[model samples]
Target chain A: MIRTAVIVFPGSNCDRDMKVAMEAVTGSPVAMVWHGDAEVPACDVMVLPGGFSYGDYLRCGAMAAKSPIMRDVIAKAKAGTPLLGVCNGFQVLLETGLLPGALMRNASLKFICRDVHMTCDNNETFFTNCYRKGEVVTIPIAHHDGNYFASDDDVARLEGDGRVVFRYSDAVGNATPEANPNGSVANIAGISDATGRIVGMMPHPERLFEKALGGTDGRRVFESALFSVTEATT
Target chain B: MKAHIKITLKPGVLDPQGKAIEHALGSLGFNGVDEVRQGKFIEVELAEMDEASARAAVEQMCEKLLANTVIENYAYELVA
Candidate 1:
């Protein structure tokens, strides 16, 4: 069985959704790790669910990035534990420097909450293996700070290394610059580190997992993590 | 001695609160405002100490608590 843990901070509204997604895929209940806890339980995969941590004070994910558990999260990520961050969790990952760049507020200066299309950019990442390159999926995005930005050089580097895992796309699955919701440099919706162990994305794949809930695109994320550890041993 | 710390979103990081403020200013008859950005200000009182220690403490505060370095920047100066 693939062991997993979901790290929950105060105000995390999507922890349960992520837990359900993981449970549906792994056939097990994931341990819920708290922000104040100094340790994380042993697990093959770790997920940081989304919400307005610390009331989005100082900045989105700013305070949560410094929470005690994050130190362990960072250490675990460095040790090659598969970690996934979504929405506010993505903000936390960036703030902790686990992933590069930052997720800023939308360009329109309004809280964007609705479904958006995304294109698969990386087929090799642990969080992307289930999707073929260029595959399009519709996932919901509900965030104020969803704009992804990095230095010009950083953008170039990410594109060069194929670190960008997903990009915003039109309803037809075409990645058009006009479909960008937050003025992200390259319409990027998700990215992974050079090692591919850590992944962060702005869209809420967890929210779209069940067919009854509207879609099953989220199954891909959990499936990729399963492939993560299994592929290593095989 | 007292120190004031200002933490701001780094350049190019979107500032929604700042944008709202800018919008409010425009509605209130202020014009020609190119942009608006929001930041945080914190006041800290410290015992008489060397400048080096004060700077170090402030930096520690940023790294551990005050600012999220990946998204925001912070600067502090002692007063009195």
Candidate 2:
């Protein structure tokens, strides 16, 4: 069985939703690890769900990044535990230094909540193994500070290293200015760590994991990642 | 001891909030506002007595938490 745990911080409105998504697909009980804890239970995959952690005060993810549980998350992340951060969770990853770059306010200076197309840039990572290269998928994004920014040189390095896993794209999978919803640098919508064990993105893949949710495109991400975790044990 | 910290976005970074503030000022009839870059100012009171020591402590805080070096820079002054 693929063990799963979801980290829950204060004001994490989506923690239950993330748990529902993981359990629905994985058929495994997911633990809700509180931010006050020092460590998460043993699990194959750990998810950092979206929400206003610590009310997003002191900079979106700043305060939460200093939480006690995050200290353990950071240590294990370095030891190679698979982690997936979604939306505000992505902000936490950046603040924890587990991922590169920073998320600033959207160029339009507004909170955007809508479905956007994303092209799978690299399918070799654990989280995206089921995706075909360059395939376009629909996912929902809702955030005020989703604009991804990094130094030009750092952007180049990420591209060169193939850590970039997804890019905002049009319906036809073409990366265009109009298709970029958040003005992220290089149209990057998602990326993985150099080890490919950690993935962070602003979109809520767990939000559309079922047909009733209007799209099943997001199911494969959870399924693909869980499969890898289960496969590793056997 | 009181420490004043100013946090600003690094050069060349896009500041949408600052831009929005600038536009709002323009609409309110504030002229000659070529640009307006918004930042944060923080005043911290510490029990430390030495001015130099307090400034150094606050500077460390800036580097560690008050600022995100990836996109922002921080400057601090210690007041007696």
> Clashing pairs in model 2?
none
| Candidate 1 CAPRI-style tier | medium
Best by lDDT: 2
Considering just the first chain, candidate 1 attains a TM-score of 0.97
TM-score of 1: 0.93
Model 1 spans > 4 angstroms off: B10-20, B69-71
lDDT of 1 by residue, A1-234 (tens): 788999999989999989989998878678999999999999999999999988998778888888999999999999988899999999999988888887877888779999899999898998889998889888999998888988788889999999999899998777788899878779999999999889999999998888898898878889888887778778
Q: Distance from true position, residue B1, model 2, in Å?
A: 0.6
Give each prediction's DockQ, rounded to 2 decimals.
0.55, 0.82
RMSD of each: 2.0, 1.1
Q: What C-alpha lDDT, on a 0 to 100 scale, does residue B80 get in candidate 2?
A: 70
**Please, what are the lDDT tens digits per residue for candidate 2 over residues A119-209?**
9998988788989999999999999999999899889989999988989999999999999998899899989999888999899988899
Estimate every model's Cα lDDT from 0 to 1.
0.88, 0.89
RMSD over all Cα atoms, model 1: 2.0
